[model samples]
Target: MRLPLGLAAYRALSWRAAQPAQEPSAPRPEGALLWLHATSAERLAALADLGQRLCAQRQGVNLLLTVNAAVAPTEPAALHTASGRVGPVLALTSDHPGLIRDFLNHWRPDICLWTGGDLMPNLICMAAEQGTEMILADVNAASLPRRRGGWLSDVTGPCLMRFDAILTDTAETATHLRRLGLPGRRIAAMGRLSTGASPPPCPDTALNAATQLLAARPLWLAALLDHDEIAPVLAAHRDALRFQHRLLLVAVPADADDTANLIATARDNGLRSADWHGGDPIGEETQILICDDSGDLGLWYRMAPLTFIGGSLRPTARGNTPYEATALGSALLYGPHVADHAAAYARLAEAGAARCVRDTASLAAAVIQLSAPDHAAAMALAGWETVTESAALTDHLIEMIQDRLDQREAAAHARA
Candidate 1:
């Protein structure tokens, strides 16, 4: 009485093919196409960063992200997905030949970037046969299959050589790849690709209004403060207020539960405060602005030139990302407990983009010194450069992809 599932699926496929090649939500069909495949969603996050960079630079480039269907929902929430923005995600469990052909024909990616382990042999061979340019990145020795020296020994060797570029994690992986039949010249050991956070959009009118209201006020922000960090932050503000009487402190807590304690502390220390959530006005006499709203970080980061990222004054509380503030032209001040983002903090420190303070005395001293316009301007420039450091690898990948595309175009033209 009912049709079989396979038969219905085939009919649906036929209907889709008959309608059109392009989906309305997808990018235009005439431009360059990039295909990205990741062994896991974690790896996909890094590849998605690369895709975002490529789309930002190239005028008409389309990206298609592919991942295993099993791990899509459970992927870590901290990582950036860029789903549906750059392109749609294609979930491939097992590569059926007919389905693979349909997907390739529909998207027709000009360049392909695959990350992590577990290469699909059929997909690689078919894509190679169709002359698609491919790159393999973030691979390691563990990614290779075992059980060699048999009738089917090294069966996927030729397929592995299809990639134009291969970047592995360690020198051992590079050695393993060369032994696996991929040319030594095409493979190298490089560090993992970097991931960057997208800049949150801030409305220009709102930014202008805030800037006008806070005109000529020497201000700094204490962002995402924890309960343990309140005393040190308030003490630092108290010390800094001595030299600059007109100085303002924009205090925002990581948890709203600490809000009442913070306001009580500010008033107890003889500082006039304005509670943003309680409809209090920031009059000329207000020394501390308590922003109880957690969602308006974009506003504070832009309003203040120097931001002290909270939750790092104590050893137990690790810090948040420094790029979010640096990306908005804010110079950073943080304590030493930055184990969560050690690489980013180290880079910013080395570049002279940020300063490290141990206690309230040191924090107050650094705040007073950085309040000078010339010093803050130079530090802000360094911080901006540090946040955009991913552009180096991005440019490198773009050059390689473009060169391969040019070569393929020339070869096709010669044949014609």
Candidate 2:
């Protein structure tokens, strides 16, 4: 029987099924392998952030990210891969048993988590049979694609049963899952699986060295700055420098490709600056320190007490999350374009952790005001508290994973 979609869908499935399967040569690490799946790029980004949180909670844990080929993860996951923590990404093809089994055998995943609505019945059921604890999160049945003959429920029912827990984004999703034979007790109406992430680890030696070198200097970070943002950030620095000649700007460009241009721009602004990637020092004469390396955000987040999260001052791009800056003890100054993380930013604003700036003038004024030790410390404390509150959700997810893993261990012990 031809599965419900159209000829195009059938051909796509056939092509995927025909692809050869192979056991990856990469050695599986000692700990559990978290298999995370997401259908869209946005969900992939959320999963990447979640994976980062999970790894932070458990030492030496490896994550196996699986996303649809069309929505390959780039930014944050690439960042983790570059840091040598996350394992090589596994691009899933078809729901073919052979392909899924080959991947499971090679990676030996201990747990599996799928986000969004799409369901691959064979793969999910096989994973459950192999004793992998499976979870379906952020489920919304309305978003799930329907087949021409209403065959979706038929195929999804048994596979839904295999999940250890089903976290629904709405009561409707929970109702649908319950109708499909998932027990009411195993399903809960949890919101979206997205959560703020912890700051990436920074080397202590580097952090200490930078802290020591910049001692007593009024320093602030222009974090994840873009090329267009160079002018405003530099202008803000210049404006702030008038009052405090000892002020230093730690400018981390969003794109490393912009470093040379950023350096030129800084010089054009009549500011003495050093490029950290090029082994330049943060001298007393240096007005801006260009952090060309992206990986050292953790270090900079810790070094600076006040940060202007870039990519927001301009209208073209939304800003990066302030959670990391706040988590690492930095009071935030962001532009009005923080729609991407509006909820997280709103909580920060409510807690007096972050202040929104409309232009270079406002940014400069906010920076100068936050540069004061007493005021900055209080904002940083508020930001930290906000981050801690967000951790309640993370802690809940962690507890679920731990309980499932512990249950498996106990079962094995009883069998022995």
Q: Give per-residue CA lDDT, model 2, range 240-294, as digits (tens).
A: 9998899999999899999988889888989998878688766789999888887
Span of 10 residues, lowest total lDDT, candidate 2: 74-83
Evaluate model 1: give its lDDT: 0.75
> lDDT of all predictions, in order shown?
0.75, 0.77
User: What TM-score does model 1 achieve against the real structure?
Assistant: 0.60
Name the best candidate (by TM-score).
2
TM-score of each: 0.60, 0.61
Evaluated at residue 328, the lDDT of candidate 1 is 88
Q: Rate residue 285 of model 2 by lDDT.
A: 96
Tens-digit lDDT track of model 1 for 1-416: 23235333533454465332333334437867778887765466557777777677667677788876454544433223347455567666555555667667777778888877677665665676677888887776666665456211243455566788888778887887777666899998875555555666688887887788887798999999889888889989999999888899999999988899899999888889998768788888999999876677898888888999987889887677787888888889999987656666777889898999988999999999988877877888999986675555556777787676667669778999
